[model samples]
Target: MKKILLGTICLMAMAACKNEPEKSTQAVVAGESTKAPGPVEFADQKYIDMGKASLAKFASGDIDGWVSGMANDVVLRWSSGDSIKGKEAIAKYWKDRRMNMVDSIETSKEIWLPLNVHQPQSVESKGIWVLNWHQVHATYKNKQSLTFWVHLDMHYNSEGLIDEFIQYVDRSVINAAVAKKK
Candidate 1:
């Protein structure tokens, strides 16, 4: 009985915090101060679609499709300090190396996206969380399946589109999986 009661209380607390405006280290999404260049609309369905499309393409190893899905002037911070500005250059990197290092890769994008609704008008982020994707079993060109977790410190744009895409999968997992062959 006590355990059940405690669980219920914790559940209520978590629910109450769903919309509690936090993670303002960055600004809100819809802070359109009446004058900002290309002020993006917050909670934009279009943006979400773009993200969903990009995620699908990446997971599927569709390099061209993934690049096409991003905004022209994309500001990508893939890691804590490794930031890649502009979609064109980023595209080149993907084409050169990251595109087909593997023959195929699968990810559970939607199932892993953060489901936080703690903000105003979709422009303001009530909070942020680390998005941990399901295990990705990627098959290399030689048909070797390497399993790893794709974790992202996701940031949503004004359109509720993920402007910044970061990947935090443990490379060691891939290394170990591949090491077994050699």
Candidate 2:
């Protein structure tokens, strides 16, 4: 399952990036290793740190805190086909982004805690896999359910901050939590 998912994401990335971020794998000369990282440099430690910081702030709804992390001119496209650009646009999009749930509804933390830990992904020629889709299995409350990994592909921005996210989790788990109201 994991192998199949990764193969699919690789194919998709190859197709989408064919006309875009066309695989730029330059030879790492001795002199090039010492230079500082650019804003969109996702492979470097700094880029990962900045991206994670932005996500942490975004999750907390600290707009002022995370806004600076984004580039002035940025474009965001959702799987739903809503495309937005610029800082103001991003801010406005975030305004109503909060989720409200009933008493029986579960917290995101509850669902995520079990699925968040993962093995490191190898760096390919292109960008890193920001949200590698893996599987999560659940049984009874007292029973110990295990995870069998699957491939889920998610995309982020050049700055390393996640501008997009799409995951293929267990359909049963996702539908129970995100199904439209009757």
Candidate 3:
């Protein structure tokens, strides 16, 4: 009985397939894309060079050189939601911190990526953005040392100067290290 039922099912399936029309197997013709063009991101070596030079300057205590490519009204943002605006103020703040608190800053394993956004999306401006990742070994003036990784993003304006800067780092470790007394 089971074998006869199986034979009947197979015959019914074959009849149904025989009655259906064959489908075309031709490849689809290509056409224009329907999606709107999104942001265009590409690398430019000049931005990478600038980013590296700035970091080198900072590590060597060249505050002015480090900020030379920054716009007069540039803004610096940290991962902690704290921010500092204006070139002179930023320079002053970094200078004071380095001069008073830090003894040395050494960076290694540097990686730089430069991106040019020809078309931007919401809240994003069209410009050149340089991203850098490095390890920082810092020694405080009180003879305390701490090593950490840092990620920096800098956006350049039409003048090829950085107008906005963002840094992603955890300062809590450094804060604790600094708060410890010798």
Task: Return the TM-score for each candidate structure.
Answer: 0.52, 0.38, 0.77
Candidate 1 residues 1-182, lDDT tens each?
A: 99999999999999988986665475546844545533223333444455556677877767778866455666666434567777787778767655445667777534444434454355434533225455676877545687666665455544443455667656666756655553
Candidate 1 local accuracy as lDDT?
0.59
Candidate 1 clashing pairs? 19-118, 29-123, 30-123, 42-158, 118-126
lDDT of each: 0.59, 0.46, 0.89
Model 2 C-alpha lDDT versus the unseen true structure: 0.46
Ranking by TM-score: 3, 1, 2
Clashes of each: 5, 1, 0
Of the two candidates 1 and 2, the one with more favorable lDDT, higher being better, is 1
The sequence of per-residue lDDT tens digits that candidate 2 reaches over residues 79-151 is 4455677767777666544332222211132112111212333522244434333233423222333333333
Q: Please list the Cα RMSD from the true structure of every candidate, rounded to 1 decimal place.
A: 15.1, 19.5, 6.0
Give the runs in model 3 whose Cα sits over 4 Å from its true position.
1-38
Candidate number with greatest lDDT: 3
Residue 71's lDDT within candidate 3 is: 97
Clashing pairs in 2: 133-152
Q: Indicate which candidate wins on TM-score.
A: 3
Better model by TM-score, 1 or 3?
3
